[model samples]
Each structure stands twice: as structure tokens, then as C-alpha cells.
Target: MLELDLTARLGNFALEAKFSCETTGIVALFGRSGAGKTSVVNMLAGLTRPHRGRIAVNGTVLFDSARGIDLPPERRRLGYVFQEGRLFPHMSVRRNLSYGYTRIPAAERSIGFEHVTDLLGLADLLGRRPGDLSGGEKQRVALGRALLANPRLLLMDEPLAALDQPRKEEVLPFIERLRDTLALPIVYVSHSMAEIVRLADTLVLLSEGRVEAVGTIEDLTSRLDLRPLTGRYEAGAVIRAEVVGQDEAFGLTELRFAGGGLWVPRVEAPIGTELRIRVRARDVALARERPRGVSILNMVPCRVEDIGAEAGPQVDLRLNAGGAALWARITRRSLAKLQIVPGARVYALIKAVAIDRTSLGRGAGRFLAGPAEGNLEE
Candidate 1:
């Protein structure tokens, strides 16, 4: 487990962050600018000092003001990847990567240079200088250099913030690969919801230098009260589903969740492969009764759990589909016309095309061709 409770004063901004999460998968610090996301990571990296608090990772204490204990950045046993690569322009990629590896005593080294190079796809770029590498490639080299440090935890402060869309996509899979293949824990910092939804296993939501909430991505994103912070335009619900069947004729794949089933565009994964899907509220249409002969391919029975206060002409609804949480956004006119209220049964209509291919993520587990297992609510 990673635990942190810190309070700091940075110029005019005051930061009070406190949270803990398992040291498995990714824990994302998500918020807007000046939310203290970077400040929290800086404290974790020993780059900044907190007024009072303690920080411990997997039972190892990194800081304790009361105890008067603090470890320097080098002794913290943590790897940091900044937004920029910050590679040595004068040296070849191989030598740059070896810099950290060679600094560690052989007895303390747990990660090998060759393994990191291969894992990050840096083997081919070893001979090239940092000036000759693409943005994504340069970041990959930075990742390699960090891993070679054999740290217990990894801290990434918007590692993709400097990259373009294409470069971001290029590096994302490699990060996912790193998470799955290695036992290392990661603390990822980002403001991008797409990045948070795609990569985070646990989420820490910060607003104005404070932790607003801490939970899984689905729990935090589907919340009605958090709409203002989560962004109304990009707000949606996330659900975990498994491939149950395939429609060869229509080039579609069937996914089954605890709540219901959805037929989406063809998923390349084999049957029983678990998937994480994000259903945007704007893409969902609700009806008082199930519609027939509609162009919409996905419809699930849901009950209105709660209706958010009217925000101008639009209102958000929290729905319960089976045991899973779902969200919908509709105009007040539609809400009044349909008379949607808590406990009212409704059919949620979703267009297959509305599901973005990029939002589909591969879950860590694949089942044995039976009933869908795993908690969608989790």
C-alpha cells in the first residue's frame, strides 16, 4: 500500500492531500491546473518538503515529520519520469540509459539494462542520440533510464503531456505493458480524462489544492455530484464487460456485463476477453418504453436512481442497470416529457457507432467461457 498525508504551502496556494491505495496497477492524480497534482508528486519525489505528515510505500517510511525522518530523493527508491524526456543530448541513447544503471551498486540493482531496453522497445534506438529521437522514442528512453534504477515505485508526472496525440497513443500501450508485466507500482499524474479512464486503476481527484475524492475511475466518474469537476461535456459511465459472442455476419462483438449486454463494433480480442467500455452520457437516449425497430443496437433496462439538479436546460441522471451504475444526460424538456423519476424503469438506448474504439480497453483477465464474472460496480 502507498499512504500519504501531506500539507504544504506553495506561494499563495495551500495544498492538503491525503490518500492511500494498493501498490498494484496505476494510481492516477487527476485534476485541473494548479490543483496540486504536480505538488503532491513533487513531495513524493522528495523535491518538496511538506509542513507536516507522513509518506510510506509498502511499509517503508519515506517521510515522517513528527518522527523527524526523511529520505533524500536518491535514497527514496522511487523512479521519476517528468513531462519532458530530459535526456542528455550529447550522449547516445544506450549510454544515457546506462547512466542510472551504472550508478547503482551491483548488489542493490534488481533490474537489468537489457531487459529495460527490450521492454521499452529501445533496443533499436540504442545507437541514436537524443537529438535524433522522436518525442515518443525519447520518452521511451527516459522510461528505460528510470526502470534501470531498480526503484520500488515509479512516479510519472504527465509523461505524455509534451507529446502530440499520435505520440501519446504510441507510448500508452508500452506503459500498459509495463504495468502488466512488472510488479512495479506506478503513480501517474494527468489532467486528461481519456488518459485517466484508459490507464488508472485507482483515482485521486483533486480540486483547488485539495483531494475532492478517491476511488476507482468508474465510481468517481459516474457520480452526479462530481459532474461539475469531471466535465459535463466529457462525463460518462464506465463498465466492465466480457466478450460472450461474435456476430460474424455483421462484424460486431457481443459483450456481457452484470447489468446487460451490448453489441459493439468488432473487437479483435478472442471470446471471453474482458473489456472496459466507456458509455458517454451524450450518446445515450432514454425512452419510457422499449422502442421497437429502432436503429439503435444496444438497449438495456435501467431504473432511475437519482436526478441531478437542473443545470440550465440540461440535467444528469444516475441510473442502476442490474447492479452496475450508469449515467444519462438529457434536456429538461425530455425529462419532463418522459416523467423520469427515481425508481422509474426506463430503457437506455445506445447506438453501436457511438462507442469510440479508443475508449475500449483490454482488462487484465480473460475468463473460461462461462457466465460473466467480476463486479461491474467495482
Candidate 2:
């Protein structure tokens, strides 16, 4: 396990962060700018020291204030990939990657040159310099260099923050490959919910230099109290589903989820492929009955779990559908008119087009990672 209980003061900002996650897949440190995500990353990298607390990976102590155990950056055996690749501008990509490998002794090197290069798809770009590589390619090289070092834990502080959407897409699969195929643990830092949904197995939500909440994507996204912190514009529930069928004539695919099936803008993945879908609370319209002649193609039966305190014109309703949580936002007038109440069963009508391309992602396991409030992030 990767454990941390950190405290530090950088200038006027005070940071106190404490969280532990499995030493596998990706654990994302998520929040807005200046939330101390980078500071936490730096502490893990041994670039900065916390005034108090302890840090360990897989039971190996890297830092302990009480014990006076502090390791230097190099001895920490942690790889740091900054926003920029920070590659040696003068060297070729091959040499840049080799620089990292050269730092470790041969007896301790578990990863080799060919493996890192091939894993990142940098085989053909060996001769090119960082100046010639694209934004995404450079990030891959940074990752390759880190992997070649055979670090015990990898720290990425918004590596994709410097890339455009297309570039992010280019590097995402490679990161996924590392997370799924490799045994090493990764600590990914980002504010983007899209990246978190696609990459994180466990999410550590930070706000104002403190650990606000920590849990899986399914768990954190469902909390009504955390709506504002989760970002009002992009707040919603993330549902896990599997590809059950497709309709070639309409260019749509059927995803079998916990409650029912969803027909989305045809995903290219084959049948039996699991998917993670974002259902915006605003996009969902609750119906008293299974309304006929409606254009909405997706309707799942749900029970009202909680009604968030409505200080505004609209109220947010948390629903439980086939054990998965969902949210629906509607005005007070509609709520009373529909006579909706907690424990009342209702049909959640959703338009497929309402789910944007950015909202769709991949689902791991049986879609249940001990569901909580991150997307509740769900």
C-alpha cells in the first residue's frame, strides 16, 4: 500500500494531506489549482519535505518526521514526471531514455531499454530529439524515461495538462497499458474529471490544501454535499455498463448497465466490452410513469435516495437504480407537480445524445469498486 500523512507550509499556504491507497493501478490526486496536489507530488518525489508525517510505499519508509528518516531525491527511488517532459534538449530520445536507466545499477534494474521503449511506442522515434517530438510524444518519452529507472512508485503531476485534447487521447492508452499490465503503482495528479474517470482506480479529492474526501470514482461522485466542490458545471454520476448489442442501421450501441440498457452513439468496442458513462443530473428528466411516444431511448427504474437541500430554483435528486446511484436535477415546480418523494419509484428518462463523448470511459471489474461520492466523482 502507498501511505502518506503529510503536513507542510509553502509560503502562506498550509497543506495537511492524509490518504492511503492500494499499490496498484492509478491513484489520482484531484482538485483545482493550488490545492496542494503538486506539493504532495513533490513530497513523494523527495523534492520537498513535509514538516511532519510519514510516507511509505509497500511498507518501505521513504520519510518519517518522528523517526528522522528522510531520503534524498535520488535514493527515494521514485520517478517524477513533471508537466513538461524536461528531457535533455541536447540529447536524442534514445540517450534521454538511457540517462534514466544509467542512474540505476545493473543488479537493481528490473526494467530494461527495449521494454520501456516498446511499451511507450517510441521504437521509431529513438533517433529524434525532444524538440522534434509532439507534446504527447514528449510526455510518453518522459514516462519511458521514468519507467526505465525502475522506480518503486511513479508520480505524474498533470503530465497531460500541457497537451491538447488530441494529444491527451494519444497518451492515455499508453498510461492505461502501464496501469493495467504493469505491477508498479502510479500516483496521478490532475484536476480534469475526464482523465480521472478514464485513469483512476482510487481518487484522493483535495480542496484548499486539505484532504476533503478519498475513495473510488463510484463512491465520491454521489455525495450531494460535495456537489459544489465537485464542480457544478460537470457534476453528475458515473455509471458502469457492458456492451450487449449494437444496431448498425442507427449507428448506436447497447450498453448493459446495473439497472437497464443504454443506447449510446455507437461505440466501436465489441460486444461484452464494459464502459463507464457519465449521466449529467441536468440531462436527466424524471417521469411519473414510463412515458410513451417520448424521444428518450434510455429509461431506468430508480428510487429516490436523497433530496439535496434546494437553496436554488432547482433541486437535485439522488436515485438508486439497480444498486447504482444516479442524480437528476429539476426545478421545484416539476418536483411538486410530479409528486416526487423519497422512497417513491420513478423512471429516469435520458437522451443518448445528452451524454457527450468526453463523458464516456472504460469500466474495470464488475462495475462495483465500493461505490461512494468522487464522480460521488463518480
Candidate 3:
């Protein structure tokens, strides 16, 4: 487990960051630019020392102002992957990876070169130089080099931010493989909600150098108050569902959550596969009752759990359909005209196309459990 409660003054900006993450997969530091995400990671890396508070990983104190204990960068045993892959231009991929692997004593190195090569799919690029590799390939080589170092904790600062969309997509699978297979604790930093939802297990939302909120990806994305931080355009609910059925002729797969069965673009998983889907509030429309002749393929009965504060022209109504949480964003005029109130039954309308295929994720091991019935109001 990683425990960090730090206070650092950087020029005119003061950073008071604190959050604890389980020693598991990815714990993402998510926020806008200049939110002090990098400063927090730097403190953990021993690059930037906090003026106050403490930092520890699995009970080992990395820093403590009260106790006057602070470890230097080289002694921290933490691997850092910066925004760009800082590989030696002169070295081959094999030589670059070997640079880190050779530094640690033979007994201290648990992750071997063969495992890193196979896990990162770096077997083919072993002889290639950094100049010949793509942006994604270079990052993979960087990751391999870091893992071979066998650091206690891995710190990644916007690793995917430097890559284009296609390159980002290419590198994502390899990161997912690392999250699933490696036992190392990873602290990932990103501004993209899509990346956070896909890879992060715990989310530390930072705003203006302070920790705004800390929760799981599902909890934070579903929060109405954090909408401004989650980005209005990207705000939505993340629902965990299981693949129940498929329509091969139509190229669609049916995923059942507590809310209902949604028909999405066909997934290659088996029937019992548990997956996570993002339901953007923008795509949801509310009706007092289910439409009779509507062309929309997906509609579920939901009740307003709560109404969020009015932000500009729109208002968010948090809804619960068959025990699953969903959100709908509509104008203030529509909310008033519909007389929508808490506990009121309404039909949540959604279009399958609006469900972002790129944002779909694989849940961690276990499936979600709740009232599986699709029609809560029926």
C-alpha cells in the first residue's frame, strides 16, 4: 500500500496532496493541467521533498518531515516513466532494457528479461534502435526497462499523453497486460477520463494542488458534484455488466447490468464475461413514461435518486434503474416542464451508438451483483 500526505510549496503555488492506494494495479492521479499531479509523484520519487507530512509505501517511510527522514531519488527503489520515453538514442532496445536490469544485484531482481520481453511483446523489436521504433514501441521498451529494475513502486506521469490516438490505443493493451499480470503497484497519472476508467482501480481527483476527491472510477464518474472536474463533455456513469447474449446477424452483443440489457457493438467475449460500459449523461433522454413507437432500441425504467445542482443551461438527474445508477443531463426548462422530482418514475432513453466503444473496459475478476431485473418500475 502507498500512503502519501504531503505539503510542498512550488513557487507561488502551494501543493497539499494526500491519498492512499492499495498496492494493486493502477491508482490514477486525474485532473486538469497545473493541478500538481506531477509534483505529488515527484515527492514520492524523492525528486521533490514535501515541506511537511509523510510518505510511505507498505509501512516503509519514504519521507517524514516530523521524523526528519527523507530518502534520495537513487535510494527510493521507485521506477518512473515520464511523459516521453527517455531511452538512450545510442543504445539498441535490448541494450536499453539491459541498462536497468544490470544495475540491480542478481538476487534483488525478481522480474527477468525474458518475462518483460514476452509480456511487452518486445521480442520482435529486441534489435531495433529507438529511432526506428514507433512512439508506442518506445514506451513499451521504456516500461520493460522500468519493470526489469524491480522497483517497489512504479510511477507513471502521463505516459500516454505524448502519443497520438492510434498510438495511445496501441499501447493501452500492453498496459492492461501489465495491470493484470504484474504484481507491482502502479501509480498512473492522466487527464483522460477514458484512460482512467479503463486502467485505474482507484482514482485520486486533484484540483489546484489539493486532492478534490478520492474514490473508485465508478464512484467518481457517477458523482454529480465532481462533474466540473470530470469534464462536462466526458461526464458519465460507468456500469459493470455481463455479456448475456449476442445477435450475430446484426453484429451486436447484449450486456446485462442491474439497469437493463444494452445492445452494444459485438464483443468477442464469452456469455459470462463481465465488462464495464460508460453511459454518457448527454446521450440520455428522460420521459414520464416509456415511448410506444420510438425507434430507439434501448430504454429502461428508472427513478430519480437525486437531482444535481443546476450548472448553466443544464441540470443532472441521478437515476436508479433496477438498482443500477445512471445519470441524465437536460436543460433547466425540461426539468421544470417534466416536473421531475426525487423518487419519480421515468423512462431513461439511450441510443446504443452513443455508448463509446473505445471507453468499454474489462472489470477486475468479479462481476457486479444487484437486482438483475431490467424493469424496476414495471
> How well does candidate 2 match the true structure in TM-score terms?
0.90
* Model 2 lDDT per residue over 1-378, tens place: 999999999777889899888876789899999889999999988888999999999999999999999999899999888899899999999999998799889998888897777677788889999999999999999999988889999999999999998898788777876776678889999999878887787888998889898887878888877777777767789888888998999988888888888888877666887788888888888998899998999999999988888687898999999999999988998998999999999999989988766677654321222111111210
Name model 1 segments beyond 4 Å from true. Answer: 362-378
The number of clashing residue pairs in each candidate reads: 0, 22, 0
1-378 per-residue lDDT for model 3 (tens digits): 889898988767889988887877789999998999988998999997788989999999999999999999887889888889999999999999998789989999899998788777788899999999999999999988888889999999999999999998778877777776678899999999888887888889999899999887888888878888999887788888889998999988888999887888777667988887888888899999888898777898899999988658898889998978898988889999999999999999988878765667755222211111221222
| True-structure RMSD, every candidate | 5.2, 5.8, 6.6
- Candidate number with the higher TM-score (2 or 3): 3
TM-score of each: 0.93, 0.90, 0.92
Best by TM-score: 1
Model 3 score (lDDT): 0.85
The window of 10 residues in a row where model 1 has the poorest summed lDDT is 366-375
Q: Which digits, one per residue and each the tens of the lDDT, describe model 1 over residues 56-140?
A: 9999999999999899998897898988989999999999999878888999887888778767778789999999999999999
lDDT score, candidate 2, position 217: 81
